[model samples]
Target: MQQRTFEDFKFNKQILNAIEEAGYTIPTPIQQKAIPPILAGQDVMGIAQTGTGKTAAFVLPLLMNLKYAQGEDARALILSPTRELAMQIEENIRQFAKYTDLRAVVLYGGLGPKTQIAELEKGVDIIVASPGRFLDLYLAGNIVTKSLKVLVMDEADKMMDMGFISKLHRILEVVPRKRQNLLFSATMSELVHKISGDFLAFPTIVEVSEQATPAQTVTQTLYYVPNLKTKINLLQHLLKDDETLLRLIIFCKTKTVADNVFSFLERKYGAENIRVIHANKGQNTRINSINAFKEGTIRILVATDVAARGLDVSNVSHVINFDVPIVIEDYVHRIGRTGRASQTGDAITFCNPAEEYYIRKIEKLIRQQIPVLDIPGEVFIEKTGFEERQAIAREIDAQKRKDNPDFSGAFHEKKMANQRTNKPQHGGKRYIGKQKPVRKKR
Candidate 1:
């Protein structure tokens, strides 16, 4: 079958012109399926990974529905898990809706609500907001939700992962129940499904791809480094070849580690070459850093998972996973940052022993093996410290226990060994190894 174009969709001339202006001619699979249902005033459940034009899949139709601004209360409410995503959606709306009189405002936490309240007072046709901030404003009487006509939950799985289920429910309660519902996610978990069940009514399910599959444009590789220090050494070695790894994002599992990596990179590559963002960073600082990285002013970006979902920077030459994501499905999203829009990109993952379990799960999710490469001889591999070794062992044990509720951990095995040798195994007496003791027993 021939592919569909943006003009083929039920879009007004204004939307079509905006699409042409944005240089978007072909509609992606998610867009092709989702736009019709959305425009027809039906609930839609879209399962698609990042970099698949999922944002536009929903945003375009929404822009068409709200052709012009009418009232102080928002007609559509788009809930994103992160402020970055909220901002991104708002930006996309502004761009597509620029030809019309529609107005949009993005609301998120981590900043005072005074400015957001002021924006709401000015009136907006659409509201893109994180759940918490939206709830806060709605409860505070700063937001009038009686006019809401459409509800969308972008990155629903992420919201569930971030423990925003209750907040999602609260937002749902405040919004008009008779409105059309839409939920989009890279991977749909049971929790996300539950929320969708409550959120969508006889929805059209549009799945661009199955769960946890990374982008085909991304070439993935894995390095089993011994510890954090060696991972750094490998990173330094790779970044040394600035040509191939021109624009890179280093994903860390924790904020402290991200900061540490940023500091190390800053020391070696100069502070101007890198910027880091995590939950602790100020909202403006995060936004500025992301903008800098996107503009190629920064050669590297070190970040935790919060930045992983919201980042839409294109032409990222490589994505280096400095640490395996604690959220296994995020492995797909992390690598997705690099390979986008028919561009070839490298996704290199550094895994320590403790992270082996997650790496295995990641491989299963992506349905492909990450080619393992030997660490370069020039990079010195440091031995794991006593504390780090213990930490790794404990983490592995916890992972095992999570998989198997009755799993006996390494520490448990040692305890059992002691019980077998140092104490009685059963309710019986300990056996003697000597032949004399055997004859007495006979």
Candidate 2:
């Protein structure tokens, strides 16, 4: 088969011009397979990882179909799991629809919706939104979905994981039943499949590659860190190599850990060199941090999984998993941030003993074992402290108990034996009490 180009899609001059300006010459694998079906007005279920040009595959066709602005109400609605992803999709729509007269508005919950409502009233061709904010506006009578021609659930799997199923059902009830439905997800779980059945009508399924597999362009390595302090030590040691670790993203499991990592790196690299983003950060602060990272003003960003799905900065030299994600599927998305646009990048994971269970699950999900690398001799490996060690031990015992309810783990047995040894000496005190009673009677 001959290779196909974006020009072959025969998009309108406006879209073609924008594509050319964006420097997109050839269609990616997902684009190659999905764009044709999308252009044909077929319901499409796109299964592809992030950074695979899936955004362009759907956006280009949607723009071409809409052509120019028509009525005030939105013609299309794109739902995302996170505010960051929603904003990114809106940005893509704006770029692709630059030459056309289409207006797009982004709605998310972090900031006030007054400005978003104002923009919606002005008339928009597309509305990219997070589920909660979208439902909120729709309930407030600010958005009229009767005119919606296209309904897209970007990152459908993530939406389900974030507990948006009920919200999705509510939105589905309001939209036109005959509109085109496009569902895109990185992984196809039972939940995604079930949701697709509800939304799509005999959709064409497009799978560019195996599910949950990291892109081959990313070189992955793993380190067996003993504890949190050791992981921090390893991170500091690795960051000392300025050449290889130029543009980096460090992903922590939670906001607190992300903040701790950011503080440590900020102390070493200075506040100007690093930024942290999580749910606790204000909307303006998160936006500023992302912009700085994109502009190369900040070399490193410490973030939680909130940034995993939608962040698309180019030429990220390294994606360091400061903490392994408990949700195994997130491993693919976290690493997908790097090795984008056919550029080679590195994905390094730091795993402690407690995280090993998740690592095993991740390997199984991805169908590949991450190659473990020996810690460098020069890097100092901190010993696990008493509190952390006991915590880990207790966690292990709890897991064991979960597997076998009747089985008492070592921790439980030790506790029971200590209680028995500390029991009061009832026999030794009873004789003394009886003698005192007899003397009083006499």
Candidate 3:
């Protein structure tokens, strides 16, 4: 609990003013530990979870470095896993550099590349980017990376998880290896370690919090739902409760499931009351949905894991994990959406039998047992486990396919080929032979 005022950091007056304007009175732990090393032009590996002010940790020092080299070409490049996070980092930089003449631009996919290209042509001081679109523009000679002085890998763990290793490698090869490197992540996995090994030279390590640790303010609970349908009912019941009815973000595992949950909630509640956001939705739609949620115009926002990254909304009363995330770290981040800025909040995870493994992983990461609550009533209890239903559906589908003698010759041929070799399935769902329908279609 080391409390340091912004003035102590010796940030430029412009940046200090911007920080004051942004309402960040005190420096977060990561920021205090990281900014000095970064200012000294040292490679840094910062490990901190969401809501820990990791962005400012690098941004403040990077801005300080850029202030002297203002007229030079793009001196900094910050890579984020999602467009939203890229935009977020860039926004922070913009606010911090308002009085300074340093320019900043965000380059990402899902929007027109023309504006991004034009910005690159104009030569920005900082560029916050997602890996894919940035490389596309860079390789096309639309953006220059040869003079890159600082490279910040924001959410480095997620980049590796998203299979951006190759892209990162390619970008690294092109940029000046002698430049300052900063890597930040909520959790440090083996993959993240490997990636860091490649990108960072001898680096200053900063670990403000334990790996995958949830914020202390977040109150986590597990609701036992027997099936998916009942989980929905439980969610409705929970939301209707007076205390839980405030601004909420419901995390779904996939885009389809998010859409389905959104539609169901809208129909059950009111269309105007809830909004669905995911990668499948347009950029404007996602931004609008998030803004609406922040403004309280939309009480509920159902979103996939990717789209929910870097969301800065405050006062989110509850975060419902409608679907337990495949990746355990995601559970930490999802719940982190609430319980931010020292405010107490609730995170209710709806767990089905099949998803128990995911929940266990989450609990292991957070190093605590999530208190479980059984859904009230026999009907609700029986209908709670959505993961089990999904597993059953897959099993039924496999059985139907196996039993279908006339399903397809090619399918059987491929299946038999795999079976003959006795190759183990990668994901480890048992191969129950498909079932054929007895009724014939005329």
Candidate 4:
């Protein structure tokens, strides 16, 4: 088959101009497969990983269908799992609709809704929102979904994981039943699949790549570190080479870890070079951090998984998984941040003993083992703490039990025996306890 170009899609002059300006000369695989069906008004279920140009696949067609601004109430609603993603979709819409007169607004939590409500009142063609904020505005009678022509659930899998199913159902109940639906996700989990059945009507399934697979452009490597401090040591050692480690993102499992990593990097690289973002950070702070990272002002962004999916900074030279994600699917998303736009990048994961279990799960999910690399001799290796060792042991034992219900691991037996040994002798202490209470009263 001959290669297809954006012009072959027969997009309007406005969309074509914007595409040209955005420097998109050719359609990605997902765009090639998904855009046609979506433009035909068919429900689409897009299964693709991050950084695969899935955003434009749907956005371009949605913009084409919208054509020009008609009514005040939003004609299309795009739901995202996180504020960052909602903002990203809105930005894409703005970029694609730049030549057109279409108006778009973004609604999400952790920020004031007053401005968003004002935008809705003024009238918008597209409303990109997180589930909770969307429902909140809908309940307040500020949003009228009767005119909604398109309903898109971007990152549906993540929405379900974030416990937005009930909210989704509520939104579905309110929106017109006949509108076109588009569902996109990195993975097709049982929950996402089930929810898609409810949301879409005979949707066209678009699978550009295997589910949970990282982008092929990324070179992945794994390092088995002993503990958290040692992970930091490795990070510092890698960052010392400013040329190869340019514009890095460090993914931590929790906000506390992200903050800790940020503090360490800030102290070493200076506050101007490093910024951290997580759920606890203020809305303005998070946005500023992301902007700074994208502008190349910040060399490193220490973030929790919140930034894993939605962030789209170009030319990220390296992505370091400071902590392995417990959700194995997120490994793909985290690494996907790098190696975007057909640019080669490195994804280096630092796995401690406990995280090794998660790494195994991630490897299995991705259907490929990450090539292990020996730690650099210059990086100081820290010994695992007693508590961390015990935690890892318990986790391993739990995994063993999960594999075989009847199998009792060493920890289980030791725990049970120790409990029995610590148990007070049945009746021996009762008389002494009563006598001691009486003496205290006297």
Candidate 5:
């Protein structure tokens, strides 16, 4: 069978030239399925995993719809969960609309909106923005949603996870009632379904992959490290083979872990070769780090989940989960950083005893078990420290209790024993005083 190409999309000459210049000849599954519906002015609900060219699926059709720049107010609005994703969509628009005069302005927080407002005043055909910033500007009269012909929510599942439903509603209320709506998400949760019902009218449902599943291009592996130190040590061992682990991303669950991993790697690999990014870092700093990693100037990038979405660096060789993600859905997004654009890559996860709980849930969510490998003999497995051990124990107990309602953990038993010892000598209360004692709330 002959493979379908971009030429079949019937895009205008400007867009075709731009697509050719971008070196994209073949349409991804999502693009092939979702583009026609969107171009036909129908509501579209696209459910595809990350790194499946979802951006182009929506962006290309929107570019075709907009045609060229005309109005002083924006005609299309694309809302993303994070500034990184919004900027990424903006770049995609620029790439596909290079030969045309269509204007796209990206609006995000973590910085003053003066520049963004200035751009909006100059007239834009498309606006890519984070939900909070989008609402803020719209409420402040900088954004004119009356002229909006299309509304798109990229990473719709993420937006719901980040508690953007109310803001989404607000944005929806302000936009024209008859505009085309397009919703895309890697996974469709109940919240996403509810929003889709509210957003789309007779929508074309397009799902290219299984929900919460990574691409086939990625090979996954697991290591049962004892604790943080051993995970770091295993990372060191992995990085020793620089040829295989050329460009790597280390995803930690928190900013602290990301900083710790970055500092350790910087000590050994030097700051010039490693960069870290998280919410604590300034916006400019995070953007610079992402750019550096994408340019291959840095061999390793340590990041939190903030970098998990819309990081379109194509040549990432490997992704190491320094810590298992508490949000199981993020596991899909984290590993997705690699194996993008149909390139083969590796995803290695380091799971300690406590984190093993979350890893189990992640396995169930993804419907697959990661193949575990024994720790290498050359890599020293340090003894778990007392504090870390206690913390792990507490976490495991909590997880067990969460699963079983009747589960009385050791702490519960100890508390019951302590209360028994402190109880009245007799079953009856205040026998000596022959009076009822007032009881306090526990």
Candidate 6:
């Protein structure tokens, strides 16, 4: 059989013209194999990770099918795990449908319901939404699912990790039973397999690669920092010396840790040089931060595991794992963000004694030994627990305080004096009566 180009697929002129305008001359392997079956109206099980062009693979076929039959309600529904990813998918649809009149709207949280409701009222042919926000609007009678022709669960594994299986079931109950179902995931866990069994009907299963495999283009290395202070020092040194790094993403395990790392780096380096984004940030702020990072306006982006799911920043020079992820597969996704679209990149992880167990599990999952770099003049030992970690954090905080002299003491004194000055005179009543009596005596 001869290989087919994107033009070989019989699509509407509008979609083909848009594809050409977007400069996608050739289809990816996954797209070539899956688009035909999808257009033929079959349930698809697509297993691929971020930066794999999975969005276009599904979006193009969906556009072709929906363009044939215009509907007032959303003909296709894409459910992603994160707001960022859902928005990205919606943007992709817009770009692919630029010449066409197919309307698409994004449904996400961290924004007012009125805007989303207004968009839905205006009527959208395709709706891309996160699971949580989708349910909220669906329950409120803001969206109609009875007209849904194609139901897609993008990033199903991430949804399972976020405990959205119940929500998925609820959505499934509401969406029509005889609709095309497509489930896409980076990897297939037991939960994803269960979803497959329940939702799909002997579907054309497509596994592009092994579930836990990281991209071959990524050169992964590990460095044992031994302590939090040493980790900071090493990161600073790495950033200073590496001129090849155009943009860097440093991943922390929690929001507090992410903030701490961002603050530490901001103080060490200039605050203008770094951007921090996580689930805690507002939607617009997060989007702006990510856009800045993408456009090379920001050099470093410190994020939590929330970014590990669906962020598709390209040409990322380095992916630094400040803290090893507890879920082993996340390591794969975190590093996978760097080496994208066949571009060679690097993934560096800082593992301390406390995180050695997690590191070992990650290595086992990826089935490769991440070359460990021993920190010079450092000793490794068993972890001393959270108490020791907090002591270290306090020590680092103290060092920061010492290095940058705190003028807060002076400010504190001034604030106290201002408070004293603003206090009422020491009298039960105003002193105006005493002043008048004194003037009269004078």
Candidate 5: tens digits of C-alpha lDDT, residues 139-199: 8988878899999999998999899999999888899998999999988899999989889
- Assess candidate 1 and give its lDDT: 0.89
Model 1: worst 10 consecutive residues (lDDT sum): 433-442
Off by over 4 Å in 6: 2-4, 376-386, 389-442
- Provide the TM-score for each candidate, comma-separated: 0.93, 0.92, 0.86, 0.92, 0.93, 0.84
Each prediction's whole-model lDDT (CA): 0.89, 0.91, 0.83, 0.90, 0.91, 0.83
Task: Count clashing residue pairs per candidate.
Answer: 0, 0, 16, 0, 0, 0
Candidate scoring better on lDDT of 1 and 3: 1
Higher-lDDT candidate of 3 and 4: 4
| True-structure Cα RMSD, model 1 | 4.5
Model 4 clash pairs are none
Residue-level lDDT of model 4, residues 1-442, one tens digit each, is: 5339988888999999999999999899999999989999999999998999999999999999999998889999999999999889888988899999999999999988899899999998999999999999999999999999999999988888789999999999999998999999999999998899899999999998999889999999999998888988998899888878888999999988888888887787789888899999999999999999999988889999999989988899999999889888889999999999899999999988767778888988999999999999999998888888888788778877877898699756875785688753334432244354223545
| Candidate 2 lDDT, 322-436, residue by residue in tens | 9999778899999999999999999999988878878888999999999999999988888899999988788777766767898698866875785588643434432344454
Q: How many clashing pairs does model 3 include? A: 16
lDDT against true structure, model 6: 0.83
Tens-place lDDT digits, model 1, residues 1-442: 5347887776888888888998887888888888888989899999998898999999999888877889788999999999988988998898888789998999999999999899999999999999998988898999998899999999998999999999998888888877989999999899998998899999999987877789888999999999999998999899889678889999999999999999998888899989999999999999999999989899899999998887898889999999998789889889989888778999999999999898988888778888999999999999899999999988989988999999899878876887778765334554555422223544
lDDT for position 6 in model 4: 88
What would the C-alpha RMSD of candidate 5 be, to one decimal place? 5.1
Q: Model 5, residue 108: what's the lDDT?
A: 95
Let me know the TM-score candidate 2 reaches against the reference structure.
0.92
RMSD for each of the candidates: 4.5, 4.6, 7.7, 4.8, 5.1, 14.4
